[model samples]
Target chain A: MENYIPVLLLLGFAIIVASSILVLSWWLGPKKPLAVKLSAYECGVNAEGSPHAPFASKFYLVAVMFLLVDVEAAFFFPWALVYKESLQLGPILFVALVIYVAIFALGLFYIIKKDCLRLR
Target chain B: MNTVDIAILVAKTLLFYLIVLHVVPIMVWVERRGAALIQDRPGPNRVGPFGLLQPVADFVKFIFKEDPIPTGANRGLFLVAPALILIPASLTLAVLPFGDKVKLFGREILLQVADLDIAILYVLAIGSLGIYGILFGGWASGNKFSLMGALRASSQVISYEIPLGLAAVGAVAVYGTFSLREIALAQDGLWFGWLPRWGIFLQPVGFWLFFIASFAETNRLPFDLPETEAELVAGYHTEYGSMKFGMFMMAEYMNLTTISGVMVTLFFGGWHLPFVADAMLLKWIGSQNLLGLVQVVIFLTKVAIFLCVFVWVRWTVPRFRFDQLMRITWGRLIPLGIVNLLVTAGVMLWLGGWK
Candidate 1:
């Protein structure tokens, strides 16, 4: 691809920058530490159970749902801008947008109805 | 059909990508120093030449640093996630018209890559894909903090995209075109012979929405909760190490440049200055050599200044509380964008904008 040069350059630059940040930190920072310094982070609270103790399924479920909808929010931009361009098929475009919105709203409704986001 | 033309295109693109990345070292330096000035403290001055080479030092550091992979992390997805984000972030530069066209080896070479008719759509689609990298990076890292940061970033960007797009309707309505070059050209002359440029005059609301959303999309200071250290302990990259983590940081700055470029192109009469008509300038500078170079310089200078503004603001503002960030986007920005759209549409329809 003619575009390969730019693509490669971008990736290489990313690698270079990332590598530099860490390398510098290591050079300047003190390396002295003990088993306690690198122990599993426990927020200064004693480990009550195994680190892999099962979290509430609801936490994972709600988090996944949150991510899904947040992404769907981003899709609205292009669709809104181009909706008018489909004037010949304006009705179809309108319905499609409506369907997308409905799906989004329904998902929101489901999340709320299920009380998934409520921290309490 | 021609080898030289293809080579020129690739060469220019490669140059542009490298140059854009090189800018980060400067941007990072600027942010550090500027934030100090803004907050009233000394920034990074201990390193080479007022920390000019701090980024270079950082570059060496990351290269030699220990890359510790989390034991249970999904190795493939973890590696792929950063690339996923980096690829789209880089690829979106394709449609941007960075400068006026110039000559290379007697054949004309445009400053942009192929000017696809769906350039605007391509930008949106690719930008949308950028979220996946963040999502998967968090998900694959097997760190709760990373996952939460990714979730926050993902949600923040998505929420902001709506108002951002809605605000652009006025411009689309007026210009009846989606292409950035066309939009820039439409604003060439003064409003009734005195005003400076076009989009700002017509759709200030759209400009605000776009700018606000632009910050959120790039995951900057206020919208940067995704990586906010205090709340999430490095957010999505909490577990990322070595070059894998480097890619994420580089991509964020690249996005800063990209969004700033888009904002300049969309709102600020990109590459166009007040009273500097190209035809009139062509007469003085000669149609061929000097004018093209000047135009390119002017365009880059404009984009660079905006990028600096991005750094300036990042250092100036306190990062918004997560609730505050969400409130601004959904409560204020979205409603304002929608209202702006409605008003613009009504006014444009009245003025025969679609005509």
Candidate 2:
């Protein structure tokens, strides 16, 4: 736990450095806001509608897939750490890992076959 | 811990901070000059010798330029997003072991900001948080392009992260530890008295998977679809101006440096000189402190090479279509990463462990 103190200190240092840079620029920077300049940029044309317009559902699908795949990746970490030691359990541990990965691999294949990742 | 220990800790943290912070300008210089060299153009030669002062000029320009919060932009989130990205990128260096320990003032000091047992995991956790910066910047800006960029960036990062983490797991399996320092130390010595026992030799597939995933994670080209200038017009930071934009640029370079450092520590033997044992170096140098300094130099040299490769690849490859990027990660890299892990485990098991 004590080993983590430097990480906190580094985070604090980062905040200080980043904020100072922002503040320095904010102080020195000119503030002149024209209606045109302040408008949302749409290739220099009059901004059409709200920029909050709906996007495709493929992005949301990616997000959901990320959650499942990311969790599976997380499960691999502990197993990886103890893998060397677990070799003492003979081929049983390797077989379990194979089964675990095969399940995820099958899911990945299903996602592919469904063409859920198609951007268009 | 005593006062001396606390003081050393502060010094070590500051040193690592300065190293990561300074890499930004140097990399900016390299990226421009390197691009010019590749394209046969002079590139920023008017500013200082060999355009070395271009980053300084950029700094001044960013500071004095007008900053506008676009109409309908969320004031709070827009302001916080740049720092959100910068902080996590900077904090990752804390867990990287730049070198082995050095005896100072009768006490041994490890040449790392933090010696966490779960250093690699901590790095991944912090790295994943960087996506929030892009997400917030895009959503807060109230711009369609920025939102598109943010969504793309988020999905790209999260997708590559699976392979990245899996690759690291492969390293952990090979080294039998999660601590970056231990992994580095384990990589010392030679195999068959000829080849260095580096992680690359032990886990070659893991190395390639990690290296390729790192390009996506850092948003470097071929994988830089989120910020494709022709398509997205600077992507998630389209509405950002002045220092906020500068912060994003700085954070990108910082992430590049941090990722490169992690790559060095995990797969390239950290600070170990090839075929040159630490004990032999200590005896040759006749001082532990000087040897520590040498190790840091070695470590930074490896990191510098990786950084150059990043810039090189950026100019060499064309940007990937958004779909292609996602397909590569999900359809290819992730499965390859799993296979790499299983193969590593199988080999270790076949040999009854590397010990």
Task: Return the top candidate by DockQ.
Answer: 2
| Tens-digit per-residue lDDT, A45-96, candidate 1 | 5434443344445445545764675577556555555655555443554556
* Interface RMSD, Å, model 1: 6.0
Error in Å for residue B352 of model 1: 1.8
DockQ of every model listed?
A: 0.16, 0.81
Q: Residue by residue across A1-120, what tens digits does model 2's lDDT show? A: 898888889989999998998888888988877999998888988878888898889999998998988997899989888888888878777898999999989888888898977865
Write the residue-wise lDDT of candidate 2 on B183-243 in tens digits. 9998887888888778888888988999999999998998997899999999999999998
- Candidate 1 lDDT, B64-130, residue by residue in tens: 6665556546767876787788777877776677766777688877666545555566677678789
Among the candidates, what TM-score does chain A have in each?
A: 0.63, 0.93
Ten residues in sequence with the least summed lDDT for candidate 1 chain B: B346-355
Model 1 TM-score on a 0 to 1 scale: 0.80
Best by lDDT: 2
Q: Estimate how well candidate 1 is docked, as a DockQ score.
A: 0.16
Q: What TM-score, computed on C-alpha atoms, does each candidate reach?
A: 0.80, 0.98
Over 4 Å off, model 1: A1-120
